[model samples]
Target: MSGLYRDVGVVLRTYKLRESDRIVVIHTKENGKIRAVAKGVRKTRSKFGARLEPMSHVRLLLYRGRELDIVSQAEAVEPLSPMLSSLDRASQGLAALEAVDQLSLEREPDPRAHAMLVGVLRTIAAKPSPLNVPAFYWKLLAHEGLRPQLDACVRCGDSEPSARLVAFDLVEGGVLCRSCRSGQAISEPALELLRDILGGRLQSALDREESPVTHEVAALATRALEHQIERRLRAVAMFERG
Candidate 1:
């Protein structure tokens, strides 16, 4: 807390401060979330301005201050040009960034969540797909121990979900069996997609032929995350707009 410290971080969000300074929220691999001031960031020739953009992975050097730290130096560790070049990829990547910002705590380390953010952003940069956003949401939820129970009923513990009108209940936080049906009913196909996503079969879920149910799964995943966090996410709304 005295000298300059360095950490690998993902720029989550930034707010303009005064004329040239800015407040940046960064999620680090070792220090979780940190709100620090980046001086002279509004200047056109600022070296680290682009590096502080949301979803940019950077190795940051900081000096701890009384209330917030000051970003002394930042080197882009993972360039986000590929993801930013495409609007679709950019939206998904931003949603991942915003979701992590909203769901995480300040100064608390969650390396798994940090790694998941980096992994998902890299995936978006490498392969821009509609499923990556929801996959990131699902992975974050699971990291927070809010993983939906799709294998069996949330109430009766019935594993033969096919026999029932497969539905996911946000209130119950998982799939509901026939005997415990509570929320809106979903098709078996949609339920299967959710299962595939939660079961670590992301490639299968994404590689599967395009279908209406995939959108349904996206909506379901978004709703589930929103319900857990108890707030509508701006990134989710923005992604839905396009």
Candidate 2:
């Protein structure tokens, strides 16, 4: 193991250890997800306290070990304090972190996923808008290889004459069209807007001032993500309640 090294990372979660220490989980740009002990972080006067909070983006000096690393020093890159201060933005931020945590494996380098997550965090911190949060989530899922087929039917792979109703198969990782939805659950509006969102046409859908479709898409996307991850995220539940 290396004696010490530096990496830019986003704090995914943190837990108190002992009276004045903390265990932090961070998604780094260089080394991917890592867990490190932030000694004395729980202390009131600890310099690393603010930098160890969830959603905080920081440059950390890590002392690598066989099992876990130690966060020797940390400097804030983007505190994300503003986003964490707002209830809605905070919930969204937590949801994003939880999703990444659920999908990412330890010490695996995924630069695209890391960049997407950092971008999402920056956006949420700068602007507290739920309108684009679902879109971000959808894009992340796509990046993670769980994107559902929105342009055509997943069942028969139809390209011509789009279906009125589309049934998203969370287990199958795509959508089924009207003709293929004989015994499958289908949602027409949700499927349509999902296509739009996946195609990066969310602005067009929102320009029409239609929110129901977005809502449905959000729900479906969440369900699909949960199925892929095989576990329900607590942050998502908190987001829904908020």
Candidate 3:
């Protein structure tokens, strides 16, 4: 591999290196997820300083190396300064970035995931709503093959509108009907909204305001994702703290 130039990408995470350098993980439209070293980025006067911050979108000229690529130059595509100014929104944005970092593999291109991340970041930067952030999580998890079945009961596949009990089984990947809810716990309203979310009804779900159903859905989605990933995100704890 030789030197290559790529268009802008969103910085997902960054770690300080020796002296004045850092390693950055970014999701690019052209190259998927990439890990590269941003030389001298930590220096006070470094031109790349702002461009390498997490959540900052940047265009890069890279030099492919044996172990990792080197970020030769970077230009900020979106500053995202206002978004990072809010601690709450920043926490959520970091969590989302961490989730993407955990879920994506090196060098593998996932256009859907890329687009979703970009969209989620934009939403956070513009509005910073907890509701939208959680919904974005649910959607991302679903796109990565962890979608919970909410339309019909997981056990019986029954499609009724009046089922009071809606049990979600992490191992089962969906909800269980009333008849099958023998030893299960569930929130009916949450399950119903989850069904709608899985069915691409975001506007309706968001229109419900600050309903308990939304919280339940967010909780359920978080639990389901943790179960699948086998690790709780550090950012979740920070988000809760704030």
Best by TM-score: 1
Over 4 Å off, model 2? 160-165, 182-189, 202-210, 239-242
User: Where does model 3 exceed 4 Å of error?
Assistant: 161-165, 182-184
TM-score of each: 0.94, 0.89, 0.91
Off by over 4 Å in 1: 161-165, 239-242
Residue lDDT tens for model 3, 1-242: 44776656889988988999899898877788898999888889997768788888787888777777889889887777866778867877887888888788887888888888888788777766656667877888888877776677777788666664457787877777867864347776776677676677876765667667777777776776677779987787766786
Can you give the lDDT of residue 206 in candidate 2? 41
* Model 3 collision count: 0
Q: Model-by-model lDDT, in order?
A: 0.85, 0.78, 0.77
Model 3 poorest ten-residue lDDT run: 182-191
lDDT of 2 by residue, 160-242 (tens): 46545456677666766667764346576666666777787866654434366666766776777787778887877765586
Residue lDDT tens for model 1, 184-222: 787889887877888878888767655688788888888
**Model 1, CA-based lDDT:** 0.85
Give the Å shift of residue 107 in candidate 2: 0.4
> Which number leads on lDDT?
1
Candidates in order: C-alpha RMSD to true structure: 1.7, 2.4, 2.1
